[model samples]
Target: MDGVKKISLVIPCYNEEKNITRTLDGILEVFKSSSILAKYDFEVIAVDDGSKDATWAQIVEYAKKDNHIHGVRLMGNFGQSCGYQAGFDASTGEYVITVSADLEIPLENLAKVVELLEQGYDFVNTNRKNRWGGEKKAKSGMANKIISRVSGVCMQDRGSGMKGFSRVLVDNLKFYGDMHRFIPDYLTVYRAKMTEFDVEFKDRDFGVSAYKGSQVFWFYRSSYYRLWFLGNCVSYCAKTVGVQYWG
Candidate 1:
């Protein structure tokens, strides 16, 4: 908070036409109203992961109006990891933040993540408060809980899409396949400082979820997701070892 710093928000979108406008509005409103804006300049980089709908159109239109709002359109649906990688590669901020495109996680919590980073935490993650709202939600939470317990990271919400980290942390990150799910654990492997804050979660009222069930479920459904489940397992095991050694 000494000098004016920049915060780059990387949002990955895939056919989120119904929610994209709200997502953009939410972030812009934060910058306009939050006290953080007094000390930090912010940019929202939305990556359109080959959205079949009008998601890209919205991004383009918004970007033209506000130079701080940027857009990255992938050649094809490269999954969230690739989308994030694209945004990260293009980001020019000292602190980088990533969130879901669904707008399920309120945009207001983003200011808290940046606040923690300012307090010297290298990585800040969030936990879903209303996690018991649905069976699928419960199952996903259970899966992530198992992963966190087995990996020994203990954040309990490794899969949370809302996260904040420094540029150094982002540079050290290696994203591939569906490895974004274990982001908190990956930061642990790199010996980065991490903390978590609680935030309310909501169900998507617009678009459908891309990953419905098991990892392998997508392989049979689309070629873009083939072997993603296997890749996820490999990344999980490899990063877990790294955590055990460094942590």
Candidate 2:
């Protein structure tokens, strides 16, 4: 806590030109107000996931003007999970926090996440009390329930855009498909200590959500795959136990 090195904040952008500056400003404001700017070094890594618009250009301009801002442009669209992975791979920090580019998740909650980690949580996730409104909220709540039941993890929000993990946890992660949504569950299975905290959520100020009805089918398919994986893991463990008992 006294001599903490730099903290890296990774923002994965896909057509977020309209909200990038506002999000960056909010993060900077949080740091300034918390006096984190004075005590610890921090930097922002914005990954432009092959956005077709001016998202990459804006990030490049900001990075050029500010030494603390770094931008990475992918060759093609690789979805949000891969974008975050790219940023994570590029980050060199004592701690890493992944945030949305829509500015929906407040940067202020990051302080609480850092506090939890410093207190010994290997991974931390955001639990949003309010996520958008109306139909969106209903859908999110239902999806979260399904994910929690299937994964056997008690998470209020599965796809929350604000999550933090220590350097060790991040370094140990292995992602495939839409596995980012199951990070907490995966970490728990691997014996990583984790915690969750309430985080402020705001409505998206720009750009429509990319998630579609078709994606829902893929999500369910992925869930089934996860079930198969879990079954195989359990079978293997059972066999190991049986072998030990017999031998």
Candidate 3:
């Protein structure tokens, strides 16, 4: 170990009261058994995105027990982008990782991302293998296919909950509505060195997905958020290419 490699992990929670404690325990267990722990120091920044449940209470409880854990409670549900932004802004590490509070992606898989980061990759993306089964898989498959076709990005799962990147990549990111879901695309536009790997998956143990059909329908009904996402992408591309394209 050349030096202590500091890593900051940020997780966004919304109504994940049932799973947050287990998720945090799993992460700490992973770190305890990890071969890289001797070289790495870690902190967990969990942002409660105004969950309507006991999510914030759980976060505060865990933070009190562990100094390495920090909790941020938002005044209202400002969406995942805002939650991620809060965590990102609070992060102070050479490498930062993002994961969902659902704990769908197994904790041990994070070591591979750390290895890739140490190998000089700016961003390490992951695909959750065997994420769903039967009908759910069928639905996700169709939806993902449509999303890929529309986005023109061929990542098997671009919206995977786990991601690892260096501080430099975080500096380049500007999180907005649904922008976290398109992180790989954004990093590609910036020409950041990247790689992808598969990770173990588990079904979400508690709480329903925040984005239900009715909620999604209503979200798209108001074109403001959609436009905000598109505008950011256009602005990024224009700035990177040094062109005035968004006018």
Candidate 4:
């Protein structure tokens, strides 16, 4: 498998000891069943975001057993964005996929993202139609809709943990303060060919959701920052044109 094109799977874990193993097994099963393992080399990178439980220990055990499995233990709980950034920096794969440790997003759907990548998409995001076995839709549907409307970017689900990116897209990311939620928008701005596909969503059976009410407030604030950044880009372009004409 030396010098072969590989896919790096990054799972960000934070006190998800009970769910981590299941998630890993699910992913491995999907890779085995889809025959993706035989076609290309792959690595599973688990980033433990200062887990206070057995998450780090489990990751270590897996990494020791399988050379393809790797683990990164952070010094402190640095949130999901940092965990993802750490994983991305550690990955050496030509293609990368970032998934949740809770198994809310099934690994079986990864094949869809990989298929789209094969068709020339630089980034592919999962759109979960039903969550927790209910057709109630995603809880963030309204907020995401507002974000898409304000940003002029349409995506069925924003902040969906199931996302795949080419090495080009991964290498260009700069994570800061919930930037993960706006990854699709960031990729689009960078001229990366992007697409989204429907995927299954499972309810977390073991652990509680880490997203709280406070995080929801931060999400909207982060969206404002994103809009401001976009505005600044336009303003800078206008200023450049003005200077050129006046001078």
lDDT of each: 0.74, 0.73, 0.74, 0.74
Q: Name the runs in model 2 displaced over 4 angstroms.
A: 36-38, 132-135, 212-224, 227-247
What lDDT does candidate 4 reach at residue 14?
92
Model 2 TM-score, 2 decimals: 0.84
Candidates in order, TM-scores: namely 0.82, 0.84, 0.81, 0.85
What's model 4's lDDT at 41? 80
Better-scoring candidate (lDDT), 2 or 4: 4
Q: What's every prediction's RMSD, in angstroms?
A: 7.9, 9.3, 7.4, 9.2
Which lDDT tens digits does candidate 3 get at residues 1-247?
Answer: 3477789999988889899999999888888898875368889999887789998888888888887788877777778877777787778889999987888888888888899999999988888788666665655555555545554556666668888989987765767667665666556566778888988877787877765333433332433234334435645521111111000
Please count the clashing residue pairs in each candidate, in the order shown: 0, 0, 0, 0
Predicted structure 4, TM vs. truth: 0.85
TM-score of 1: 0.82
Clashing pairs in 3: none
- Residue ranges of candidate 3 with Cα displaced over 4 Å: 134-139, 142-152, 211-247
What number of backbone clashes does candidate 3 have, counting pairs of residues 3 or more apart or in separate chains?
A: 0
TM-score of 3: 0.81
